[model samples]
Target chain A: MGGGKEARRGDVLLSGEGLVRRYDDATVVDVDSIEVRTGEVLAVLGPNGAGKSTLLRLLAALEAPEDGRLLYRGRAVGRDDPELRRTVAAVLQRPYLWRGTVAGNVEFALKARRLSASERRERVRQALQMVDIVDLADVPVDTLSGGEAQRVALARALAVEPEILFLDEPTADLDVSVRRRLLGDLERIVRHAAPAIVLVTHDPGEAFALADRVVVMEGGRIVQAGTPAEIFESPATEFVASFTGAEFMLNGTVSKVDEGTMTVRLESGASLEAAGSAEPGARVRVGYRPEDVVVSLPQSSSTSARNRFDTTVAHLHPRGGLVRLRLEADSLSLEAVITRHAMEELGLQVGTSVVAQVKATALHVFPA
Target chain B: MDVLVDAARQALALLLSGDPYLWGIIARSLQVSGSAVALGLLVGIPIGTWLGLTRFPGRGIAVALVNTGLALPPVVVGLFVYLLLSRQGPFGELGWLYTTSAMIAAQVVLAAPYVAAITLAAVQAVPPELRLQARALGAGRWQALLLHLREARLSLMAAVAAGFGAVISEVGAVMMVGGNVHGETRVITTAIVLETRRGQFATAMALGLILLAIAFAANAFITRVQQAAPRRRRPLTS
Candidate 1:
């Protein structure tokens, strides 16, 4: 890797080589090398405690890795450089606003640079308008609700007009509707501003919706990094499939193997048959997407699907046009997403009996 | 109860009569305590901020020592300062003992730790993210410290108030080091002690009333600050 000759200016805004961060005696983030290109949104997607946020911090230069070289503009620099800080801005998860009016919080970064008062005011107004929160400018930060506060925080970051924007789980704490709305707002802002961005999130949908590229991290290492389509559809690792909620991981053991299909007994003792290579008496893990699982009433119909589990509807919630159901079958828990119209037709309710139907090809089985 | 009433009456009378002697004692008390707390702030705020924000080897021990210093016995501090300035001690040539400087030094020992301890707790109470956010938004180390201090202003003000209150109301250290000499080392606390020992209960009560007023004022000030959303600042009118 002749980094000096190969590195091109304006293509990559920031890069890290051999980054390592540890906490509680565990190396929570250990990336060999990563880069953020200009005018692209790179989303770091991972499950809870997967060190996604730590990677964001390292990339943003907020935390100096114990062992690593952080390079800016293809040149290594001190981690705490004021110039570097000035060029980058971040909106952390559950961001805290300074004790002042919304406008005050927005102007803080500007003030550090000693911008003219008129310039600061103009930028603050523009940022607030960008987030559609101009009316909230005079409101004190503490008085704003969670969604409104998050918008204010975004406005504060945008007001800096930074070269790079780092957003760590920006919408994770928001309500579903609010998160969607904010994501839409962010897409619009990103299009207009076109600054390099590094977004850390736990949801694959969010990464697909808002980022140009997705990097999947697990157990402190980058398992895969590629276009969102590649990550969501053709994930390089099963951990990415399980983490993105694209698939549900359930513990199961093989009951028997006959012909080409393997009968695996789930935690609830219910058996499922899938086209897999696992042998008899072998412990295996099952993975399938909620959208692939069909929720049908018991005795509604008989289908050629090889796997059907007798389940009781434990809970259900609306997810846009679909309804997410949490079904329980004794000792096993499963999730299924079906259309609202189907939900109304089936008349599914909590404690109602339903058999979850899945095609044999949909289940991806792996040795436990 | 009657003795208390009579003492209050005498306190009011002395205050109303424009007595210079009592005023001198009060002024001297303020001078000594104010100087001690000022020095304490100068030395303690930085140390406390460092302790609160940074992680280093033996930090726990340093923090434990600071908290312990919060409850430092004034008499013990006074004895230590006294020995440091005593004729028999090593640095005795400077001769600070039996003087107001000696009282101020001892009180500084008592007050600086209170300032430091409170500041440490206050800085730690502040959200670590605040400092991180500040630094991320182009603030240098000193700027980040200032920003964090502004966020924890309530705790800092409380620390100052506690320091002042601790020193102004303390009697043991100043008595041991300053010797309560009239017109020189005698502050309100020592005067009150002297008056009470001589059975001049009214004078002692009058001095005690002034000291109580100071304490009450300090408490009221802190209460007002704490009650305010963050700090005493007019809304930006631009």
Candidate 2:
């Protein structure tokens, strides 16, 4: 599950081939192929308006594709297929709750399936307990807070015990702390319920945290799909790199090529060793995560990191639980995130001179 | 001023003593208007909900046409009903002119558009995502539509109240079609008109007060239903 191209866990529960959706004159979703296997979480990650939500709608059968074949369990199906409706459930960013008690809203899913009263009550109770909102079952949805309302929405979806769950930014509108808590609960539920889930969100952290495999979309097409580590470690395009939070970028020219490694002379006149295939005299952009960088005082003992740059701390931003150091070496700038304890131990301050180190393996080189 | 005081006293006596004639007129008014509004709701709500949810090339014009019906003159509707049921008219063989059925037909025409236009507004006021969410939660098409209508139930009730208020208080259409027959067709409004024309100011005033009371009660009911909708609370930040 951690490898990008590893064998997936279960059989294909749903698949869409050559899906295309258009609105007015703009094509919002155009995918050649996609599949959702049983007991796996597939995340569609992208920036805003990248068609991730649209693609989820297409797969959820909330909207039909203009041209495509949608197959559920190898059988062709339309949006109105009773099998699809019976087996699938979805929760959206906005908690579109009904005008009723939380339990009443949760029971709606069971009622729609024509479950008996006892079954509905038991399922509704269990679903509310799963989301840890059992006490709010009888509370009116309108009186509940946003986070609580969203929990009711999730409970409603889970009450059906669907085989496939579609979540479109369920926590997007929640507060950070509330969202974190909901994500934790959702993660546990996914592990316990083990339903095939398709999660659509612009938040990379959410995808990395929940998804077994991710499909990054851009401009109405799936640009890349892989495991979380693969997506974070080796992005296929610059868009993926930047969108995945690869913040440290440096422009350089290849000065020498040896074996499989290349030496790049940066525009700041700092030569660095990186592992990539490139001919001499090619301009390239090198990207790395801020967490990969190690910063130290100039008088420190030597470290084994291959590429080092003497930089000045230009700006210090205190992020939650960490300090982001904006370091500048002549015209080349790089950001490094370290714990607040490390910053205090090093006595780092703005305008302090430090040496930033990066291993050659951590750098990703792209043709400029 | 003297005539007003005398009429107020006489009106209270007639109302308190349970004058059968006045009571009968009130009953007939409620029966005719209630039936008209009920029939109107049966025909109007579905069309209004459909118009609200559906999108077609001429939808704007259709909505505009429904809204235009909201302003339809009761007298013109009365004339139209009269022509359709006249001796020389198409439905003259049934001879429904100057009858309660003809009056009901005219009021239905008056009330349906009123119901439809308001119902359309009410259905449209509900967020479209609610329908989508209902479908995503495993509801069939009719089930989803029912959920949406349930969400708009308060407004739909207000539509009924408004429709009743419009048709029950109306005199022109019912008078033209029912001919204000003494024992059968003389509703509250038509009876008030007759009393006023015959210089019976006290009876007219008595009947007018009863009509106003009925209108006030319907309006009060509408207000309560409208305000019964839960108020949105401030969103929690944490």
Candidate 3:
């Protein structure tokens, strides 16, 4: 199932081709293509206005796409098809629990599928236990706190034993501690339940922690989709790189290519060599981690370092025990982090000359 | 003051003596209005839910029409019902005019719009997410609709109280449509009007008291149903 691109066409459980959803004149969701197959946790990762929730709604069959076919199990299904709804359940960011007891909320799914009385009770008990909220089963929904309510909502969806589970920012409203615990529970659920999950969240950390495959979206369109390692280590777009906190980005043109390495001349007039297949004359975005660039004084020049730039410490911003130095050259702007001891020992300050060393392999060069 | 005191005493005497005529009128009032409210509920709830939840081009207009109907004058409703059931009118051939059925019909006309509009508001007040949540749980459309109505049970029951209140206390519409016939269409409100016109102030006042008592009782009952923990400690079915 984790064969990446090959899994995409093998057993596509749900797919949307050329899907478009508009609210008035504003297009809220525009997916040229997307698919969720069985046994994979797909994370739609984006910011608040990135239409992640809207895309989840579209895939859950809760909404009708204005310009696409929502194929379920390889057959075209109507947006109002009751059968389709039964196969999938969604827990929205701020889910509305029916005005009832916790058990009743979970029982709702059982009721909808017309399960027998004893069976409903059994399923409700199992679902509540699974979410670790069985003790709150008989408690009124209004009495439950946010975390408890979210757990009950999860139980409600899980009670259905759906083939697909759509959790739209499930822990977006939880406290930090609660969110962490719920994330652990969610991962465990994915492992034990074995249902295809589409978790929608703007938190990249959450996506990387939970999802098997990550789809990065921006401004209502999916910009990148890959494994979490691929996304975090070598983001395909500048937005993905910035979102992942590997924040350094520079516009550069490839000047030379020899073997597997390419020389890129930045707009700032600094040259960097990176191992990439990009052809010469290609405009590309180069990104690297702040910690990847080793900051030291000019006297301690490391000869073995291949990509070393002599730059000045423009400013220092202290963060706890680490000092963030904003570096500047004639045309390059970069930020690097070093310990306070290093700052004290090197006597680095504004306008101080320093050599920034970065390994060529750490530079992520992608065609812009 | 002495005259008023005497009328009150006389009213108590008329009440204690169990006047068959007065009791009969009270019974007729209950039957007609109860039947009307029932009929209204049977037709209004589904329509109101549809009107409240659906998003079509003319939905706002339909909702506006229902809201406007909430303020419809009883006399106007009576006049229309009378015309519709009049011999020369289109539905006049049913021969229900000037009968108890016509009184019930008029009361239903007064009550239905009130019920529908209030139910619409009640159902709308239930958060939109409730339905979405219900559907996400695999509920069919009808089940989801019922769940919304259930969540708004208090308000929907209040709609019933409003509907019954409007129909039970109305005189103008029933008078025009049923002609206030004795031993037939002489409900409490119509009888009160008739007795008052004939200068029987005590009897009219007595009927008014009974009518108020009935309304208070009905509302009390509806309130109990509304306020009582609508969801039982255990689900009634499962």
Candidate 4:
């Protein structure tokens, strides 16, 4: 889907309307409305105890909602409908294999579909091959490694060719390289098969890398849902921004209104420009990604293309290939990320006066 | 001390000799306990599986009732069965009183709850994710249960073993219901009691030793099955 309107036309593959689930006095899931498209991957991102798993359980029909309805393909299905039952498959966070050969585990799903023996065998073979575990087909399911087992689980779900796939933290426990590889394979599978995917995870990078659209959840409610680029460029809420790694939030007051753009002056006395229109003298919050802020040596030439400010480095911490610098300018603090090589070349140190350049378009402004 | 040693030696001799009387006692014990365990498996496994997987208003009450039955005294059950099968009691016209069938009925009652409670624990021990995964994979409710039972085969077998162990060693119910007939209903436990009361300490000790061996064998076989069951492994693919 190229536009927002087209994105909503993916045919309401799954929807939760006013869904609520309660355990004793605690409400675990309280989504007002959320929908998954027919052939798109929607990543549900949240921290621990944020009800991500609870929402997945609700959608999978493993747990019933206390209130509201779950519509699948425009029909209400509440864990008892055989038609809806046949259309969905879920791969949970901790994958479990039945007592049998790996081939047998994959065949179990196909058999449920009433496929003939020959057809079942072929489907099982294809599923195994898809997960790159064909060689382990005859091996006992209990003998495979963690990553291998997860692949087998996926293969089992894929064998049935489900219309929807719910994956709960599929690669949470996997190592970095293995997780990356599995994620890559999953991306290919979803793209080619075009099954609606609801992937729940706490990793922002994973969400950004795989999701066609990202839904940020907190306290059992969906705070925001949009394309990855849309969320990155402009988060609808502060929670969404922070969850997506928008770390520095500057509280400022609107100083001047220029057409659709607003110039806001922060407590640090540094004025920043943003593209959102707001009434003059209104309170606002401005945020920018750390990498979007560029650091240069003092006395650098100001260019028309950049919003430059003179600042002193408050702190420098090296992380991986980049060094994150906390800079102070007129009592306002901003975080900037620069390469270690650049830091060494600039001989940047704490208390050193420097020029921080931020692009106006990169700055996201929201009503306080 | 010498008399005790002599009785022990005589008991061992009788066992090694394969006395027909002793074999008869063993056969009767097997007949009663085997049938009871089979019936227990039939009724207990499904109930246990259901109780483990589904939630209902009285589920906790049912579980507690089963656990309470675990400590139910054999003598108390025997008394209840005796009263039920006695003349002037319900179904007394069927003449089940003092028969092997009556004894088996008592044993079944005594054993089924043990099986059910153990099986419930076993089935509950299985991760809930496994059931969810099965359902998500498009398996119907029955299919999910069957798969879960297969995954938990070893534990279920242990439940059956526990039930057999409980019934086989029980004396009061078998004695009260079967009347401990000389050639028919004389199970090991009942025969041991009878022989001891009749001053046949040697025969009593022999049957007691055989009973212990059978219990040990049953437990060993169950343990072997549990060990043979597959270890948890990650799926081959996700």
Candidate 5:
């Protein structure tokens, strides 16, 4: 078993190479290639109708591909292969409980494998305890709260002790607090169980917090795939940049370069320094997180930073504790996230001229 | 109006007198209809479940045919069964004509399609996600089928009840096939016909009332069974 574990760890547990599933003229899933490595959580993030759920279904073998193949453990598997089926489990967006007590749903998968009655009972107990719903075991499944039902569904999947777990919007309908708790519990379980998890979610924070790597899908194909940090820091395309909420895009010419840092002169005549290696004359697209740009009243005798510009506030949108100030300087439009306290102290309003100060390390520059 | 009231009073007296002939007819009706419903359920449920679960060529046509069977007239079925089971007919050598067996056989034909069509609709009503979830949990196709059937059991019971109701009340096929023999083949409906034709209005009216009561009782029993059966739960042991 140890040798088998090592061999399996090196093997790709789930692989979809050139998978294509189309409905009439609409393609639901068109993947060039995607692989879930052993014990890794790969979150597939996309907007609604972006084919994330469809990809999970294709991986789970619930649906057949119109074209291409899905392989498990270096062998081809269709929707009917018993060995492949045993190694994979999925929690759908809306889980169904078989008519029975909560204990019954959890025990179903174990019983399917023909485990002894004692073994099945033990497994079901462990699963129920893992999801913190052992007390609800005797309760009828239909009477469970939404969160409780979802937990039972998760427990049912875990009872199988699968090698791969697919979660398609597991927390899509859950409230924020419940979602956080479940996600945290799930992260712990995935770490301990060491199953390759493929989570499809629309929540950016959930993806960033739980996934070791994130794959962004749009219109039935993968747009980008990388570590969350890599994807967030330097998005490969405009779509990724925008989808990940790195929304502000500025075109500029490099004015100065020093040690992997470049000061860019925007077309709006504002100067911004970014952490990138670029020649002095190269044109580049510079981006920044809204939170990275600070808005404040003009300060005299301040330390000279690489990027600072005085701009009029075009819009002030308050969101929670943060206020997003859309500032305009000539043709340059930048968004800065300031605290409500800061906004109040600075007496900021739309059309009020203020200094939009940005840290050089906070800006990301990519060649045009 | 006086004569109608006198006839109704006479009918009530005959019914209260516990006539042996009327009891015999009632017994025969129970025997044939009960056997028919059992046979129909045995054959129809599995076929309906299979048809609903498995995707095959001509599946739509098959379902359509079964749904069409739901509206099949009893007289037409009686004619068809009579042609097949009568002397000089294809099955004449079996010596099954004008007997309880022939009645049961005819009623089975009438009831089977009712069972099949209702069970099909019941199975189809189960959400596809439930099947997908079962499959994802490493359940084989057979296991998924069992789970889906368990989930749809209530509706399936209602289908069975409908089929039972259909078989129990049907008279055309049994009359045509059984030949209404005096003791052996004479059932409630045929006996009623015989008494009415003989101008034994009291006995006929009494048999008619008893038959209506039997039908009502059978339906009430089925409904109570349906209501008493445990609500569908995802089966733990399957």
Candidate 6:
């Protein structure tokens, strides 16, 4: 991952400025500027109704923005511009396959361009082989499973060898295993081809897995845009933090500020030190992931975590091999995740008192 | 009972013997209805596709008008065509009255609406995203539209079947404009009516059976064509 973003990113292929889309009385997408660079995967991550798909549509020129201009290689382009259309392709959430055999579906895009029959056949062969579905070429689309159908959709898009690809939750409806396989295949294919890709998804894990740059969107606007590590480590807002797996939130008021460090007094009378400066008496929120909170026996002071809380376990939620413990202290509650092996060793159950520790760097502080 | 038995026996004899008069009426019926449906397809597919796939200010009214045509009674259409082809009407100078051309014109009016309405329904039935997908894949406007039509092709065949069904079986329109002239404009439906009125029950029964067989054969052919692609799946050797 060293210098991955700068090393892999190529020249800007497409850009949008002052894009806005409104449906009737409500604006569904509003973005000031966005760029898509060659050989880079850009993920638009957000919750449902966040207009991420709408933004993709705008950038892809599938739907013209009500107010904005799209530049493809420094030239303004319209949704109906054949030049723009020839270089771009999109695979939607649902496959929307034509009523035909697999090979026919793949050949359709090629046929649209009025390509010769030989070239179409060759490209169709290559695309199906790329998706590893060449054997099913002659099978009708209706008999394909969902995963297979999605592969055919991908193959159809790939057949034209587009310069840009837009994927709108390509694996949203798939099962976990199927999703993983498709994601793996997609990663390999996209990396090999190195086309500028705009992937719209709600799953942060997917963004992390594929994106070099992540743009977190909310409320029809982009809230933050940065490298995936930058987004995961220093989210700019509570929504971003929580959406990226920082579920534990505590509201507090700053009590002391010194040397880029501040101590915040929690509502439960617990004071915690975090690495950020704020005016004393300023209200703020502290957020952290469950895995960042360490649990230990009361007498064990072997860890160097800056803040420690003695709390009793209120509930235990087991997720696969990991267990999530809801710990309650005096008038305060927080969650911590520990391994099943650790829980067994500690003999921790509801009402068992233990110490929870978090390092100052683990806490993300934002104005409430 | 005896009259019915005699008519059925004589009807089979007339059919097997291929009576030239009866065969001529059958041939005329096919010619008029076939030409009308072909004309209907020429006129209806584009209008229906345009209405179905695009949005414009009067689209609703246009659609409503097409829907209204779907329910238009054959006799009403016949009377409308009758007045137009009559000697004193607007198109009277054409002198097409009591001729096969007039009958074809009347059936065209009847069949075009069926083609249009069904084509509209078929186009609308395709998933809207399909056209968008085609465009996203670099299909030109008309190419996307052709793709949409191809996707709705099976249903379009039904449109053709419906149009043919409406005109071929219809007696009113053809009879009014055709005038059922002997050796000239008489078609299956009209000839059956004439024979029945003249107490030529055997000939009428024979014509009736031929009409049913033609309708069945046409629909069956369309159904077969519609089902051919969907049911075919080559077995994968790998």
Best by TM-score: 2
**TM-score for each predicted model, relative to the true structure:** 0.80, 0.95, 0.87, 0.91, 0.88, 0.93
Q: What TM-score would candidate 6 get against the native?
A: 0.93
Q: Write the per-residue lDDT of candidate 6 for residues B1-238, one digit (tens) a residue.
A: 9988889899999989989999999999999999999999999999899898889999999999998988888888889999997889999999999999999998988888889998998899899899988888888888988999999988898898889988999998888888999999999999999999999999999999888987898789777866775442333111
Give candidate 5 misplaced runs (Cα > 4 Å): A1-11, A250-286, A300-303, A313-315, A341-353, A359-368, B1-20, B54-60, B214-238
Give the candidate number with the greatest DockQ: 2
**Residue A206 lDDT (model 6):** 90
DockQ of 1: 0.25
Model 6 alpha-carbon miss at residue A8, Å: 9.6
Give a tens-digit lDDT track for model 3, residues A259-326.
98889998878898887778789999888878778988888887788788888999999998999888
Clashing pairs in 2: none
What are the per-residue Cα lDDT tens digits for candidate 5 across A1-368?
13354544535777998999988899989999999888689999999999999999998889999998998876788999988888889999987888889998988888889999999999889888888899988998766666788899999998888888888888877777777788888777766554688889987788988898899998999999999998887777766777888755668899998998877888877777788678889988877888878767776424576577778999999999988888888757888888999999888888888877788877877777
- List, residue by residue over B141-211, the lDDT tens digit for candidate 2: 99999999999999999899989999999989999999999989999899998999998887888899988
Better of 3 and 4 by DockQ: 4
Worst 10 residues of 6 chain B by lDDT: B229-238
Docking class of 3: acceptable
List the lowest-lDDT window of 10 residues for candidate 6 chain A: A1-10
Model 1 ranges off by over 4 Å: A1-10, A245-320, A323-368, B1-4, B86-99, B220-238
DockQ for candidate 2, C-alpha atoms: 0.61
Residue lDDT tens for model 2, A178-208: 9989999988887655468999999999999
| Model 3: per-residue Cα lDDT over B1-238, one tens digit each | 9867877788878888999998899888889999999999987887798898889998988888888887889899888888899999899899999998988888877788888987888888888988888887788888888888889888888888889988899889888888889999888988988898998988987888888887898788777866675333443111
User: What TM-score does model 2 achieve against the real structure?
Assistant: 0.95
Look at candidate 3 and tell me the lDDT of residue A212. Answer: 87
List model 4 lDDT by residue over A1-368, tens digit each. 23332324467778999999998999988999999887689999999888999999888787899998998766788896887788888888877888778999999988878999999989998888888899998988677877887898889888888788888998988877889899899877766544688999999888888889999899999988899999888888877877787865568999998887789888667788888788899988888889999888865646554468788999999999999999988757889999999999898999899988888888887778
Question: Mind giving the per-residue lDDT tens digits that candidate 1 earns over B1-238?
Answer: 9988998898889988978989999999999999999999988898898899999999999988888888889899989999999999876898988999999899988898889988998899889998888877777877777888998888899889989998999999999999999999999998998998998888888899999999998888778867776332333211
